[model samples]
Target: MTTEPPETGLVVRYSFLWPREHDRGEIEGRKDRPVCLVVPVDVGQGAVVVFPITTQEPLPGRSAVAVPDTERRRLKLPGDRPCWIMLDEANSDVMPGSYHLVPLETHPLRYAYGRFSPAFMRVVLRTMGESIRARQLRMVPRER
Candidate 1:
């Protein structure tokens, strides 16, 4: 009997909201705007998880947090809701910092922002698949 290898690539989906805070000043100033609830993905081999942010304006100096693979796997991410995937670091050659899945209702704004597109999603998914495939191949035992 022949056995097929386990699927390495795991898809996680969840919802993310950008909170805006304004400071109470003479003219109302804002400070320390950071991204909240970032779950990083570990691709192994020094390649950290990536967070692809698809918003109207790219948050400067803000990044996602890298979480352990075990925690990420165990996380009960909601499929019906929107979510982001930590693929790799922004400096890494694989993927970017963050990718936001805009809700169907907010797709218009997403397009307006010009941060995300169908092509971009395709590339991201392809890269993720490749990473998973690579991991799976490494786990496979050789016939001696």
Candidate 2:
């Protein structure tokens, strides 16, 4: 893990266990993927939440925000195939202690890929807030 703590909006690689997968008895994510930190800092005592970013298009009834071309380029994400930040669910972990957070293979010492732009982050936060209020958001905790 990096000595520096992660900040809000930082995109980090993580083994994110989806809610459905967890319900099916999976203990870990099948693979590591880029995930965006949603909470500004620790929630409650030390838990932090992050939303997964995916190249797969959001399906019907799912909540997501497309990453604009400019933002994708700025973040150096792969391809032009389109990406979306999934907002319907998130992973919760014990920040500063979770073993799930990982560095990119290309950048061993760094745990972050990049941060989302403030304006775009605002849109994500707003949508996530709505989801939370509507009881549509699911959280999967990664702490043992």
Candidate 3:
């Protein structure tokens, strides 16, 4: 399938393969999960930047911005599932599958999935930048 540059803050579903063990660099993520596309459009190579959404809570002292349930409701996500957007390691660059946008009842869906509020996207980016500056993220060097 052909790929296009998805706008930032689109809640797209992707099968993320991330490091489960930093020391081992064991990658995981078999099932498709929701992620926010954070990369600006018309950037570099085909690799897209994204933040994976998860039900797991953030570790203490980590930069994980918990998506408010109100926002989740606005996005038409199940209210029962509390999720955290890992600002620390949630940041990733990968080739994406054909993404499906999650629809919202409160807001208009952008592309195939739903869109995140510009304000919220700003907060995410700012928090991620802070995390990077603080050196809070575990580095897994990729082969160029």
- Show how many residue pairs clash in every candidate, following the order shown: 14, 0, 2
For residues 1-144, what per-residue lDDT tens digits would candidate 2 score against the true structure? 454465678888889989999999998999798898865442565567889999999998888899998998898876677899999989987666678977887888777888989999889899888888888889998875
CA lDDT, every model vs. true structure: 0.27, 0.83, 0.63
Model 2 bad stretches (over 4 Å): 40-42
Q: Per-residue CA lDDT of candidate 1, range 1-144, in tens?
A: 111111123221212221221111222112211111212256432232223333232234333223333433344322223333333222121112223322233332321111223444455556555645555211111111
Worst 10 residues of 1 by lDDT: 1-10
Question: Model 3: how far is 66 from its true place, Å?
Answer: 1.4
Per-model TM-score, in order, reads 0.21, 0.91, 0.70
Better of 1 and 3 by lDDT: 3
Evaluate residue 143 in candidate 1 and report its C-alpha lDDT on the 0 to 100 scale.
14
| Rank by lDDT (best first) | 2, 3, 1
- Model 3 — TM-score against the truth? 0.70
